[model samples]
Target chain A: MGKWIELQAVPGARDRWVRAEPFGGTVSFRRPEMLVMVDHAFLGQRQPKSATASGRLDPAAPYEAHLTVGHRCTVGCPGCYIDAREDGPAELGFDEWQRVLDKLASLGVFHVALGAGESTPLAFLIDLAHYARGLGITPNLSTAGLHLTPRLAQKLGVFGRVHLSLDGAGRDHMRGRVGFASALMSLRILRAYHPRVGVNCVVTRASFPGLGRLFRMLKREGVVDVELLRFKPAGRGAELFAQMDLTTEQKRTVVQKVLQLARRYRMRPRLDCSFAPMVCAAGYDPTRLVRMGLAGCVGGSWLVAVDGRGCLSACSFDNTAGALSWSDLGRPGMMTPFTNWIDQAPSPCAECRWLQVCRGGCHVVARHLTGDFNAPDPGCPLVQAQA
Target chain B: MNRKAKTKGSVLSVRTGSNPNSSSLGVDVTWLLGGGVLVGLLTMVGQTLTRWALTRAKSKHGQMD
Candidate 1:
């Protein structure tokens, strides 16, 4: 009988490998190229190494669909990423949203994150969540918590997780009028029925200082996980860049502070992939970075976003460049051409050592700053320091 | 400050300076540059300076300003 070992990709470099043995085998090795599987035969039976696995990517599907079911939002935070407005386009009908869910399910997507501007019709959101669950896709939601009534909260019990946006400790001022109270009420209501409740905070220069207090509040409110979203310069957020964007020194400080706070809190910390370059620039070791769950930019590669209009973007923040409409997906090949476009796209930061993880930072930031999505992210500490 | 007051202060202090409590005068120059107003002013100054230099050279060569 031969013992089997599994090899996984290293943290930063995609080609590097480390052996992982499940059956208590202690064989340790690092190879320049990815190794599929190797067996050691004890009965003198020789077996050829499986080289076919090297050519194939992971069999598990890597894509998660972030679907914006509605375009209207009433909260109107100052640096709203989607620039969601109360008067935004009406939401797609229930049937249309159901069809979209079916298409995502057919594509082997096991997870879907439902989002809206704010004021998404509660009935439509509930129906969509039910439809997605029927297809065996785990449904999650991100909301501003404005219209999360008790009835709506009961309906949302079907969701796997609910992420409430809490930009700062002071809710009303950081969010909008009555935003703070509403979010808290919603959190309390959701906690009564939902087991997995999380907070999504946007990290900016101003809010970065108060994150510890914010985390303490979330922990008190029974939040199980916290996702620290990097502030991207897009939509109305671009207007506040000068005031909110962290400088190189501030970025280093922010990363260190976040790591410290995350360690102190009981909540699980997950940072946006765009912040990977900042961690590397702060001189954190690769092992520490990987342990922090800071896998580089998975945008266009592992995740994709579908906006309220059924338009596809590499990520939610990247709603501008290379966006494909829902009509485009109806074509014959089915996402092959889209995936090829994302993979074949040229980026100036492709030669950087951290390219695999950073993926040239967020495309939205690059496009906003230099008018070219292929340009290196201007906010990247490495890019800024070099320039 | 109490937690509530501290949070309120932070929210009200979303301005362009390291000292969130300081008056508007503490706003940094980088913020101005980001707003593009400074860049536009610099471009205008550069254009005016070039025109003035050309006028001076022509006068030295006995041409009308």
Candidate 2:
């Protein structure tokens, strides 16, 4: 092998690879698609270590961590959830992230996705990715690509996954007003550099209509992986929530369409943890869906996020008022305040049949709408029907 | 899951992922995407599943006989 990253499959340590059956042994992520015949396969892999077992907030630590490099964004989508602006704060520096990566590696975290309001300006983004990889943690990226140049794509050659943000197939749903042509060019350039490139579609009522066309557009570019992310109502310009939030019926429709399209196009699709309730509501076997990486409210469990200010939250959308800094909770044995976002779910969700699968839907969204972090996802039809 | 499986006493499996620099793009994932940092080409590299399991157990628990 000219160059390869070797990842040991430690129990409870999750990764992008299918660390379970239908794939094979969870140990050694030598290659994504390579096959190795072991003398005898381990009967089974260990489940993720929960607080009940370890009596610690994070038993094995989160398998994946997200790093928000900065908020300095040039493309100002009217309903931008992060409030990212051209002059937004650039709080975390290069050294701070390196230290953060060191902690995660020691804690057994194996995957990280780097997102920036705009990565083109951040010269160290690729180097940061390389640093995480050196620690056996695979690093991915999500960018607005408002100003992605061919030279920049070539520089990003080391990254295995680089998802470009797009609202829809064309001008009608594209955010950042980064016109349709500009978005297409960014996709082409990134695809040429890293063909495994994916698209992060911000799902809202406004963008859902053109989703079919968007899927087709991405497929034409040889893009095979896609993730449907909920359009969060946070940050500035959130006043547009009423116009953008998916309606009750629209939520189910979007989920249905996403699954249908995944099957039709032979695409590898992922729905954000917040979309778990809707996905389960469609009468599919949630356990079987595990093959597709479906899980509910992975925050405080399978994943966590660190922002530019060095704050760590259960999920990136978490805005629980007070903050948890890397200097504070980064230490082992400290409990993140986000624990209640999972352990103390709303009464309805706790009593709901899909409780374990959804973890009461999205705690951040519930807190944003109901002022109660334990409240069920406001968009959940299960809660609506019961109401 | 652009796969062609052959099972004996040992198990052999393949999913879909390719290098961006490679000219061959015949991979089609069955149920997963962006599996991991797969660096090997489509060429065969045969190894026993027992080694894979022991490596996993050793890594997960710090060392085992």
Candidate 3:
């Protein structure tokens, strides 16, 4: 019952959201939450072409899985969640790792993510990628890029997407904090293989002011896609308000700048807020890049993540967010936090103006920061202004 | 014609009413509703347990020292 929204653009830049005069709002499908609502209500509910003529998928479906090769890291960033769990064991066994992957395949998994640690062994990671490819699964790996050696990169070059952490320019800002240089070197090697390489830039107190420099460097490196991760205070990073919490107005300015930069480099920058459109939950829907997040969950069980100790979690940040644990992995029909959310997200979130669109802010983020899943979305400024 | 009639008679016998091929119709609506409530309660228990576990882990394993 909410208004339909769309993307409006400024001259020389790509279209953004602006209200259409008579319709009273924008007119683009960029807002999937709103678009999905419109398509179902106003437009007749027709089955998608991807589905069978009968309007459902066949019983036999394939799924993707996530494998956490090792849980060891060489660097300690100021706000990293992995660093908080440094006390855990080193890695998951090869066979146990395979079991996680096989489970994903059984569930129709198509995409797999590796790493929440410093280095997932070059040999084991390559083997996993090769294995995923053997099963026709796309393997995506994220790294601080600090420990990625030239030799290792050349060897494990075949991958779906290699996300390198490029926090900022110069050794001073990136060195001990987020390990950007090693990630750069790794990115260079990955480029030799010509796999799709994207940069994960964490916007924090230290790196927010360096966006201009960071994007320029990315352009020069021939990187086209960048994922901007907003800083959420979790784990050791939870004390960030004292150092780097952005005010509402500041975040708006930053979001606008990010959009401008996206146009400048002709590089697609996906915001966790924009791309995901909902709060992520751990362990409910097993068939998405994200299990429980609204839009970002790779529908069809695309993305899966496993940690070093052979623990299965929905997202890399799952441990910090506090959802289902490693212990719940093999149970037949265990009740996961995600399934409950799917069934019982509160009324305000379920029936809100943005519910169909935003998927009720990230629960993990909500729980960690505000202690409530029903709290106002941190992106309230953008969501409210649009409607 | 007699075989067709017998087949229809058997089909009609399976139905509660005399509608041949209608088959049996039963709704276990209570079980579905009951499962929903059970799931909700279990999730609350899980969250409370997880919070407690994380608090304990944070105190024990969640530090830089």
Candidate 4:
């Protein structure tokens, strides 16, 4: 709600361009070109983003908040930031979720991303999606797509979009939880729907070689967009950093290759380096992706994770404050105390080149692996564009 | 903006690539000025005529003109 506005892509335009009136401007239509270009004052929201309208939103507005439905996760992926060592139960109840939605609504938050723990409870998620949509807020969910059955996918049609994680082409890196065939089957099921199907590929030692191949397959399969996520050295991610982390040269090569692949295939791939360069506004960015023209994680500040026992944590980053209940939030009257509980990250990440893009990597991951979320990121090599 | 003339000449040129006069296409400002001015004038006239016609029809139909 700061000085920024979010624009969403509507499916019908042949060129598929979205525009927004910059705070006080009007939209202009050019008949000959059949193109609508807002005056110089407006901002362009769609990609192959216009360089003219690029500027930072007022940082004062709360950035996007990433919320965890529960600490429950079945997968024991080695690099997972949210993996609970033991099988944690789904702690969030419908009433608590409703309250959270109401709070976000009151704040005029436009985007809310629900991840962490599996989001397979269709009835609950559908209600949540409907609630967000009712408030004209966009609700995005990141799922393994392991349980995205036909019926479930149809139900999820209410949400803005779903970004399914596909770390590699085969089950080689996915361990045993997400079979490649199963993920692809789910993709095929989702492709027949209205919402976009985005594939998230985490570039790691296990999946690096297959990145190009995955892009190729997505293009071959006629998928419109994909996301290349740079792996952060945090949580279980830190343990494997020695093997999974790329050298500066290799990182450059990977970015170049991915850029080339995207240009060649005309496939829209969002480069997510939220875990790199250490400092991130992930927990601070506004969730107005649908209302404001900005992208990336939005409304991540109002987000908090409440466990089955009603214990609160910033995210999955443990050892900071094990499990404080709702009563411990703050001075009796406060709403979002999770933002205060998270420690501020240190820099060159603070003054990094990609600071504007990646506010800071995940705090939980940074804290667990390096014991300091503010320190310069070791994974920043991947965030740099290959000149 | 000299290249603007070249592009216009290329569009109007008989043999786009084969013409030896391609290098001199930039000098052909006449086409650009003439065509551009004509377009502008036509747009104004077209708008004016459309408005006039609409007004006339409205008045004839005893509606607010």
Per-candidate iRMS values, in order, are 28.0, 10.6, 26.7, 21.1
Per-residue accuracy of model 3 over A169-235 as CA lDDT, tens digit each:
6652453544555666777877776556776666665667778788888899998767666665554
> Which regions in candidate 1 have their CA more than 4 angstroms from the true location?
A1-62, A171-173, A284-293, A321-323, A330-351, B1-65
Looking at model 4 chain A, report the run of 10 residues with the lowest lDDT sum: A26-35
Note the Cα lDDT for every prediction shown.
Answer: 0.54, 0.61, 0.45, 0.45
Against the true structure, candidate 4 reaches a TM-score of: 0.60
Q: State the lDDT of candidate 4 residue by residue for A45-129, as single tens digits.
A: 2323443343433222121234456556565667765454446754667777666655554443334566555533556667877
User: For residues B8-62, what per-residue lDDT tens digits would candidate 4 score against the true structure?
Assistant: 2111001000000100000101111232453344334333333343234345544
Q: Could you tell me the TM-score of candidate 1?
A: 0.68
TM-score-sorted candidate list, best first: 2, 1, 3, 4
Off by over 4 Å in 3: A1-66, A84-87, A171-180, A273-304, A320-336, A339-351, A382-387, B1-65
Chain B: TM-scores of all predictions: 0.41, 0.27, 0.42, 0.42
**What are the per-model numbers of colliding residue pairs?**
3, 10, 23, 31
Show model 4 residue runs off by greater than 4 Å: A1-56, A172-175, A233-235, A275-370, A382-387, B1-65
Candidate 1 pairs with clashing backbones:
A73-A118, A296-A357, A297-A357
B1-65 per-residue lDDT for model 1 (tens digits): 68643332111011110111000001111212123454344334333332343234335544321
**For residues B1-65, could you state the per-residue lDDT of candidate 2 as single tens digits?**
22322222232333233212100011222333223222122112323333454446456655342
Tens-place lDDT digits, model 1, residues A1-387: 012222222222223221222211111111111112112121112323542232212112333567767667777778876777888865567777777777766544545678777677766777788887677556677777776777778888777677777776773136764467677887788788776677777777777777888888887887756667777776678888678777677776656676566567755565566666676676644432322223455554345667777776656676563457654432433344223333444544555655543556665677777887666778878788777
The TM-score between candidate 3 and the true structure equals 0.61
Evaluate model 2: give its TM-score. Answer: 0.77
Which candidate leads the pack in TM-score? 2
